[model samples]
Target chain A: MTHILDIKDLVTNFYTYEGVVKALNKVSFHVNHGSTFGLVGESGCGKSVTVRSIMQIVQSPGVIEGGEIHFSPDSDNGETGIDLLKQTERFMQDLRGNKISMIFQEPNAALNPIMTIGEQIAESYVFHRKNQIIEKILGLDRTGENLFPKVSANPLFLPLYHLALHRPDAFLLELIKKVPFLRNWDRAVLHTAIEKSVELLATLGIPNPDKIVHQYPHNLSGGMKQRVVIAIALASEPVLLIADEATSNLDVTVQAQILDLLKDLKKKNIISSILLITHDLGVVNETCDRVGVMYAGNLCEVGKVTDLFENPKHPYTKALLDSVPKIRQIGDLKSIAGNVPNLVNPPLGCRFHPRCGHAMAKCKEVFPEMTIVDDDHEVACYLYH
Target chain B: MVVVLFGVSVLMFSILMSFSPERRAVAYATSAKQIKEIPILVAKYGLDDPYHIQYIRWITQIFKGNFGYSTVASSPTLDAIIKYLPTTIELNLFSMPIIITLGIWLGTIAGIHRDTFIDHTTRIAAIVGWSLPTFLFALILLMIFYSQFQLFPPEVISDHIDDFISDNPDKFIQYTGMYVIDGLLNRNFEVVADALKHLVLPVVTQVTVVIAILVRVMRSSMLEEISKDYVITAKAKGVDINTIHQKHVKKNALLPAITISGWLVCLSIEGSVTVEFIFNRAGLGLLLVKAATQLDIPVVLAISLLLGLIYVVANLIIDVLYAVIDPRIRLN
Candidate 1:
């Protein structure tokens, strides 16, 4: 299968008062097209940083020291591919919410307060597919011939003479004078755009889209707002959707519902792939086809979900699996030893050496590179290396 | 919600006052004639009605913009209220923007730079602003700027545009209630400049304390907002630092700042008394102070009602603004 997104030797660092923190160290992973890839790790293990780096969304004090994020568009000819890391912000803006989109964790806070749900969703649609919406609204779709004749022979009352008679400079000056800052003209345009936006919201799952479109973000319930955000991300039919702990903030029931919605949408829309960043191993087991285990800031293991769960190779993966409580059994679950090491001054050799039960003297002295143990399984530990 | 409670309390007080035989005694000095007229005065003011009925009548009159005649001034209380309201509004409008802008900007900078010299200076400034009595500050400012430097005149400046227009009979346009508006209307550029210059010291004196408080509130709120998970999330998203500040930090910080601003505006009317006295400005503060000093019950009651109404309305606006700024707040 062709890789939709590839990150090679990613190293992200944060400059802080304490010291230089290596947030992500030599992280490398590939997410194939139409596949659900799960990145599971403890808090502060750089799972979120990796996903954010893919979308070119890292902020100041934190820097991507070295990395390459290559996203390939899944066209028939495979002609569209771009290195997102090297692209300008303008280019990234064009790509974001169109070719790639993100579903944030706290849906309540993520949506803009002043903006209505419908308007926010419609903004993505208008921005990415302006011509389509305008054409549809104006009944100007030209799928047939005689397009030129239709344009020339149109019988609608033309304001050509009126427009011509009003000199552009004079007209503009008059408009400015009457509006006192040209506020009214902008409002007229905005009002039309907002009207069309309500129509777009109707296409989403919002009930009474017209009424909901006028209501501010505060008026909607948490679930309704999350649906609105989902609608926004899916407006442009992006090929890759990054759900960064998307269900973490929600209750267990809501989490299950949202997860099911995402899964359902993913299957129906076969063109898109999901990159699910989560700390919940259970969520990964249920929703992911492939899983990548991260330790500290390194990708410790990568394998098919079934294989990894059935016969985990990496020590970190084994410990994580062992820690999960099984419904069939009734005993206390095993817990992973030690907390994640501070990235600012990480231990020498293996960053996970202090926590790994299988650590050897060699593990403490030499850092291991990822070694492919099988056709679909890779582990970055001495056992596999 | 608070308005409804206040209204009820005022109604209850009015009813309690009506039943008491001392209504005339309270209204005027006790004498043989006054004692005979006590029941008549009570009946005239509808003080004889039941508490609920009297409350309804009072509320209806207030709704119809009939605040009732002043017992002391023998003039319409509403008119007296309307006359003083514009002056208070002018003072507030001049000072509010300065306070909000200066506070947010200085506070944000201080918060962002925590222990730096700018931060330290801002902290000291906020401490002084919060701790110092408004009356003392007003007096000090008056002595320094007006008495010592002679930079400001010790009176409210009123270039009556109506009188000016009547005298000149050419410039009639009045877009704003400000002198600047009148100056511009008559095409008097020099007059506009002079007006602005004259306004400088008074506006500064009125706004200084408010600006200091706002800065402190904004800084603390910004600091708290900066530490939220979403800010970290935005950072991880590789969003520009400036975008994070503008979109994430600023909006979240606005919550507390806005809440404080509402209360501050309400309190400012009361707070302005000392400042008004110091500047010798004929604003509501001065009128209220004078009314209270002279035992002018009618003026005092009118002023209290007006202040209460303004406070209620301002709080409502603040609540609406909260919904505007933060989507998490549900209006319903």
Candidate 2:
């Protein structure tokens, strides 16, 4: 199997007035190509920070101090992938929402309130797909050499339109553009973008996409807004979609619907791979092929979802799996014994040894590297070593 | 809006009516030499009548466009407003744009460069501008520019330009009462230059004093907006850093500043009394001061009504602007 993303020795910290909050501590993980990968952890356990670091969008005061995130965008050349953390911010800006898109947690606050749905979706297309859209416009203009007689007849306008579409910063088109009536070409080009947005909305199964495109975010329900947000992320047809708790805020029915939509998208080959960051164990169990269990900024276990659920290795992973109640059980719902450690002053060595039942003297002395115990299953514990 | 204006007028009338007929008769008396005629004037205007009757008489005269007379200007109250309003309007026209653009620009840089030297300097400047007394600021500027350098003078225009307009009616048409505008119409750039020179200090004083609140509003609003989830979403969606700040964040930040700017418009148009008085410009604010001091009730009442009307119109314009900037707000 080939890996799509690999994070090695990633360290992220938040500089604050109090002290440095160690958000991510040498966290390492990977997502397989064409497979759904889930990272599951407790509420404050740095799951979001790991993905945010990948996209290079961590807020201020939170800095990626050191890491090497090699992204294999071209599946055939996975061995020599480019290091994402070493790339320039300009390169990252071009890659984000184009090669690797992200969906945020809050649906109500994700979309801009003042912009129309069509405009919101079209923004990504305009930013990353301008050349594609411009080509589309040129194709439309050359349909049997008679796309629109008015535009085609004006030979002067066509060349200027080409120049306007390409070198928009030039003063030639700007002079002509200042004439109020010459704005027709702008509307025509914008119409192409809006049409593409309508198609994207339709693919998301939004009803009456043509009408919905003209509506604002405030006009939509919670589920509908999430769908719109998803549609926007899918605007550039990224190779990897990072859904950061995308379905947590919706009701049960809507959450099920969204999850099914994600599953359906994968099946239809509409999306290549998904890196879903969620806290719901049920969500991870049903959808993910592979899972990584994290405990207070450290990845404790990584394995196939079925193996991790049935025969969990790391003590924390075992405790986490035990905490979930089955459909028909005779025993009490087992909860973890101790609180998750604070990241600012997390315990030295293994972060979970204070609560682990199998605490050894070495568990308090040194942190353990990930060790493969079985085929395609790894655990970060002295027991595995 | 009309009801509100009516309410304001009634309130002012009741306050004026609280005084004795002899005291209220000051509105009718042309001069203090006619002290003996105070009773006769009171009788003629029914100043001693019941409250409702006095209110009805005053409201009737206002509706009939007979705003008594202005002893200060030696003309009708309406005529005095018409003659003096242009100077105040011109002063605000120059200062309001400077106030709005400068405030928004300073606030945007301050918000973007949070905790940096630029932010600290702008914040301190805003604080000083806000805390300093308006009259003191105006006086200091007047002393520096008019007294020290003698670079700029005060009042509406130089005596020569005023004389030119009054002396040559056929040669230079007074198309508008504002000399800067009318000078251009008449192709008299000298008059325009003279008028603008006199405008510099007052406009400076007005903008410096009034822009502080707007900057504070804009800065805090910008700080709040850039932290919104939509901004993060924009960054996530591969938007260029410049567009995220200038377009998405700025458009949201300007919403609060728009409300503050509405107050700015009214504050300027009612014509900063301190600015007009310190500069000795014959605008409506100066006229207002003269009217109030002389107990010229008709002139004071008319000015109050005009201010009430201006507030209503400013509110309507603000509503329109809000609808334009924010899609969540719709105007019917």
Candidate 3:
């Protein structure tokens, strides 16, 4: 099986005035191609930090101390995988929106409020798909030359279009662009990009694409704005879509709709894999194929969603599953005993030993390595070992 | 806006009314004979009436463009403003652009490279510029550039250039009532260069002091804006760092800076009072100080009203710009 994204010993730290926060500690995981991999954890368990590291967008004061994020731009061909951490920033720019795109948690804060929805969505195409768009324009011009011989031969658009595609900043091109008759090529390119943006929005199930395209983010509802953000992410035809708590901020109905939309997009092969980060276990059960349980910057368990939920091995995962309130339960839900340790000075050995119910003296002295109890199921605990 | 203007006019009138009717009458007197007939003039202008009636009469005259006589300029107050306004406006036109652009540019550099040597240097510069008294700074610059080097002289155009323009009006039309502009219009490079030479010391003083306020405001604003979630979103979209800086961070950061800009412009006008006085330029600020010292009530009142109007108008422009820069402001 080919993994679209693989991680090995990923470590990230935040340098603050107080101390260096060990946000992520030697974490490792692999997201299978065409599968929805859910990272479930409590707040501040480094769930967001994990994917932010993968995308190389961790905020300032935080640094990726050590990590190997092996990403295959071509999903079916594993041999072409590159260590994303070693890639140049310029190379990362191309891979970011083109091969891997992200939908953020807060739609209200995600989109640039000043820019119109259409321009924002069309930006991906203009930046990443420039060659393809230029080629398409040239192909159309060729057809026009054959059919409308007199018009095509007389107009300066063909040359100007070539200049705009090839040497956009050429002095003669800029000077010619000021002339009224020769400006059509540039306008046509932008117009066609906007038309593609409208189609992309329509594909995301946004109504009144023609109207919404011209409106700012402030003019759209929370749901509509999230859809626009999704439209932008999907515009470049990314193979891996990382939804960072994408539906957590929306209303329940909107959340359901968004989840359904992601599922439908997956079914249609618009996205080959999804790294869905959420605190809600229900969302993972409904949407994810595989689940990874995180505790104090550590991945405590990894297995299929059903198997992890039914047979949680690590104490942290078991406690997390037990805490979910059931309809018929009369007593209080089981709560984890200790708070998440401050990662700056996290507990030694196993991070969960301080909070575990059956922690032996060995649990405090030595950390257990990952032990496989079932096929495709792994847990990091002495009990499991 | 209208209500605010009206309130400003009323407030100015009431302040003018605080002077006894006899003292207020002196504003209408032009010569020794008029001074003798001050009582009659006072009654004619309703100076002895209730304050509201007095305010009405004053506004009625202001509405007709009769701002009374200015003892400082020895001319009609309106005529004095017309003559002096252009020089102040010319000084601002040169300084405003440099102050705004440099302030924002330096602030962005400092904010982006926060805690680095560049940030520390700008911070110290801002502190020094902001803390030093403007008049003292202006005097120091005048001493270094004018008294010592004799490179830049005080006052509006030099005596020779002024003589050339007045001596040859046909060649140099005083368009816009500004020497630099009129020189440019007439293609007189000598006069334009001379006017700019005279402007250097004052412009430098104003730019330094004003940039301090803006740099601090913009630096904090930029820091706040770059930390916002939208900036992260932009980065996640694969935008180059410079593109994110220019297109995303700068535009959003300008909100607080825009709010400060209009006030800075207005404050610079007040700042020019000292700049003009120390530089010996015959602009409105110089006229204002001379008028106040000599109890030239009409000129003082006129200038006070003009300053109030300027502040109001600057605030209106700032509000409009706020709406233009941030769509959220428009929605609200």
Candidate 4:
């Protein structure tokens, strides 16, 4: 029931040639532990901007005006929560691929061209599980004793153990000297990492993972590339995975497959939560436990999927839901009028006032605050207030 | 096919023009008897026969490595070519690394920091260098460094191998024709050091124009690569900016520059003429100019053929290199 990640009154702005563009103003949402939370909005609705802010991926000219992104690490002992927004970039980097990984929209561009898919995935495991891999290689576990009885019995390695403990620097120097010809040893390490990556890829329903891992990103199909990207994100067993329009570039069938893969992973990997950012309301309906609707640069509504779909409280959310074609419905599919207001010089009060059907005189003069309607639903509109 | 056709035509034209009797005497002739003497003069050059026969005889002699005698040098045309080829190669070998390294490095930096003061300054320098003729730049460099500062030697310092061997025969064979290479091969640190110091100004003069062209090309290519979606993806993946530059940006950007560099190498054989002249170095550029001015048809044709051959070979090498640098370029 506890929230794994929380964003409070987040505001992100960009300094442009025209003026300060408020990309995200007072936007707030949360992902409960082990729950898939969907952030659905049109382009420029601050969905991507919000997730990037959590990952501290925003570049200069785009500034975090105010916010806090608190992440509660999923640990057996229940460690203290960390505020990601306040952390230095170095600290964020330590947490990024390890604690929170992201799968971007374009698979070809998302993966590095110069590196093979296997090497890049292996790097994640190498960086985050350095100590674990080292221990596995050295045949020692955390207790400072040999895990393998055969390894412990080797008389040749006895001096190595003593050297490692008594003269660690000398041991390292000796190791470095043998490294130029350490192909077998290096292969052993890399092979283990690749095996782990392949296993992760297979779990994502990628056929012939063994063949796929050896290939470069360009060699794979679009869907395969996406699946490989997903495999990489899942490599470190992160607490949260951000799929930034991960399925947008894929075909409809592939999109369904990718969605199913994510759902399966979520069920199997009980500790991980997904923050799915997309513009598709139908996708959110199928996969998300809860949905947050955004308009312009503000969160217009946040509610349980069924409630938001059946009874969207905010005028903007209602209009968005109406826009989706329904097979059972008789009347024409309603579309929201007007484009999203310019962020540089947004409408004075409610950004959607220009198009909202229920816009009152006050709606154009005063901004609305999010008002709780039920334990699970919240709407940001004058009607709710 | 075009190159081959052009080359054949040039060969024929050079031979015909070289063997033609002097026009001045023909222009002054008043009688048939005076003109009768022209056939003897033409016969002396073996030009009184049919064009095809004359071409066949010339080509046959060329195939035998007898490129005919140079009217200007009074030596076998091939001998003149062989004597000058090494000097040109040596000059290029000395100058190329400087140009490429400086060009690529400065260009990459300028492109990465576009719109900044450094970018503007590099742009200005490139424009000035590229706009000016190579001979003009060479002369300016010669005047400033050689005539004014007395920094360079003004000509190559020829050390006889016989003298070097007799005085220090042990080290004589080690100092290759290229003093720099010889210094390194012999492990004569002082000789290597001294050769580099002597090499400074001429190398600088040669590199100036090359760097100007290369920097502009490399900068634009790098800037284009930087804007690619892959770069954004790299940033999103949290790859460090410098690593992205080294592994992705530089590698990708170098492709176009590498192709251009191959052509530049062939071009340098001809391009460095002015540079060689400024330094009074005996390279093919100076040879080419002198041959052209003196209408030394045999030498001119030989040099042109050598340059054309170099251009074709360099292009072939570049095509092969493309497959190595970019996996997308599949060799047919």
On lDDT, the leading prediction is 2
Which tens-of-lDDT digit does each residue in B1-332 have in candidate 1?
66564784485447344435344334553467776777677667665667678667766777788766654444676766666655566667777777777778888888778778999999898888777777677777778876899776555454563356457645545444455556777687755665565556566766677677788888889888776655543433334456567656787788888888888887776777777776776667877787666544456656777677777888899999987776667556
lDDT tens digits, residues A136-158, model 2? 55564344542211212244455
Better-scoring candidate (TM-score), 2 or 4: 2
User: Considering DockQ, where higher is better, how would the candidates rank from best to worst?
Assistant: 2, 3, 4, 1
Q: Native-vs-model 4 lDDT?
A: 0.76
Give the docking tier of candidate 1: incorrect
Q: lDDT (CA) for every model shown?
A: 0.72, 0.87, 0.86, 0.76
Per-residue CA lDDT of candidate 1, range A333-356, in tens?
A: 889888889899998888888988
DockQ of prediction 1: 0.17
Q: Listing candidates in order, what is each one's chain A TM-score?
A: 0.85, 0.90, 0.90, 0.86
Write down the TM-score of every candidate: 0.71, 0.94, 0.93, 0.84
Q: What C-alpha RMSD does candidate 1 show over the true interface residues after superposing them?
A: 4.8
Report per-candidate DockQ. 0.17, 0.80, 0.72, 0.30
Better of 2 and 3 by lDDT: 2
What does candidate 2 score in Cα RMSD to the true structure? 3.0
- Give me candidate 1's TM-score against the actual structure: 0.71
